[model samples]
Target: MTALRIALLGAESTGKSTLAQALHETLPVLTGLRVARVDEYLREWCDREGRTPRADEQRAIVEEQERRADALAVGHDVLIADTTGLMPALYSEYLFADTSLAAPAHHAHRRYHLSLLMATDLPWVADGMRDGPHAQAPVDRLLRRWLREGGHAFVVVQGQGPQRLEQALNAITPLLKDRAAALPPTSPSTVGKPASGGLFSRLLDRQARLPGSTRWTCELCDDPACEHALKSALPPATPRVP
Candidate 1:
């Protein structure tokens, strides 16, 4: 099975991360496919350091997000990314007045099957790193424009808590059902940035695995990876090696 890479996107104070977590937890149960999650690295990096990122650091932040998501995609049947490379790109454009990050960010987005934009409807919460509610609307508008102008089809997520989660699930179900047809063919238009024979490529293989074909296993459970699980509908993997 080809892993469906789903990115939760939006401005700060939105429920992007929360929805990512909720979807990560619930998606596997519904899809019967193992899910791997790429968490937002910016927040973790910010909390570790003492401040928010400057213009130059934006590139690194975006790269790290792609790195995390790519690594998770190696083994899981579905990749749930809290945010995409778009965040850093937006930050550079908004705060630092730089658009250089956009190209790399768009390329990073091409790897995913879908990006869901989280709505800024919920009450804003201060996590120490957030730039406050003032930045929300503008940032949301900017992100929407970025996604639209980039020729990317993105779904907008609304509501609160469980309702929001249900909305995301509803959006994803059809994608999963038609994932094989939805996935891009192995060509330049759909090729991921990772190199051939790299750790990531060696594990996941590509979309449309035939019966008796080898499939990637849970990397954490075994060594040297790429263990086949015969032919199951989903990428054949368990939480642990059997």
Candidate 2:
């Protein structure tokens, strides 16, 4: 079976590392399934190289970040990525005004079963590779804009410490259930398609079928607000009697 991949995204000092570590330790006990965590490769790269990467080197960083996460997803029931390829792509855009990575990053991002966007509610702390607290809001805006343009849905994780961890767990628990019960089995023909159920099922149903296409494409659709509209129109589910 294909691993259920979860992506954690946010600006600097948003508790991504902390929350990822917590999930890595807690998920297996909660779900009784093998779990794997992919740490941000950029962090390790910075530590080893003693500096941040330049514009020319950004693609390599993003590639490695995604390569490691995809490798870990094999054989594991769940895979929590501390960060995704979108980070370096965003950094390249924010720091160097490079927009070339957007398409490839979005392609990589769609592989995730779910994306949890860490809120910028917590205070920022300086680290060796961190740019500054001042860069957080702009980076956050850029990240959201990119996700929207790419038509990807994400949950915003709020609070601090245990409260933050609790919020993340709450968002993921339902996904774990849906993934097990509703997702289509992975195969050579169906590989790279987003998992189906609920919102995803609606989205896929609306997409125009393309010949020999392995992934969903928006070639026939022009409405950017379609996702939001569909989400709002979905009726709340009624509880089942015991």
Candidate 3:
């Protein structure tokens, strides 16, 4: 029972936090897996910094989030991180601006076992702490970057509340099931090498065994012109959580 690190990522006002909370509630009942949000880490970082963070401080925030995610992944059976506005690919663009900062140092994407990408289909809301109106385009760009980087993610589009919930469940349930099947069935463990075979070998086996129909596909705009239109569609962004 290795811990599954699920990361909820997207641009500002895309409902990452709400979806994380909902998944935190629903996933355990359906799969007996726990979910922890990254907000707890962000709140602690804000307290240490003495104020809410600004956009320029994104790299620092992401670093801290990664650290917290690592720590939680160590303790929990399953951890779901509510990412900052930027996805891991976009975060790398900012963190590795200086060539001296080698690629391995900013390996945020490597931390997660699964990523839930909230799509920008709903109206952009200016929540008191949210920073931008041009969130949709950046979100779209980031989603493309995630796909290009070979990251595993699913899009969640805006819809009626229940529909959005079901969409989220549908997107992640199979992943959870697959991960569960891969586990040793003895005790909760970290998501790394298994006792008999290493992580890489297990990963390759999974890929080799994947059903052809389990491939990625976009649920939004049917237009063939959409870049990465073959990538998996995300679940809709839900409202902000209280």
Model number with the top TM-score: 2
lDDT of 2 at 136: 81
TM-score of 1: 0.73
User: How far out, in Å, is residue 179 in model 1?
Assistant: 3.3
Residue-level lDDT of model 1, residues 34-150, one tens digit each, is 678888898888988979988888899989888888878875678998898888888899999999999989987877777777767689899878899999878877877777677
lDDT winner: 2
Q: lDDT values of the candidates? A: 0.68, 0.72, 0.53
Q: Candidates' TM-scores?
A: 0.73, 0.75, 0.64
lDDT string for model 2 (191-212, tens) is 4544444323432332223123
Off by over 4 Å in 1: 180-242
* Segments of candidate 2 deviating more than 4 angstroms: 182-242
* lDDT for model 3: 0.53
lDDT of 3 by residue, 100-132 (tens): 222443365655655565556556777454446
TM-score of 3: 0.64
**lDDT score, candidate 2:** 0.72
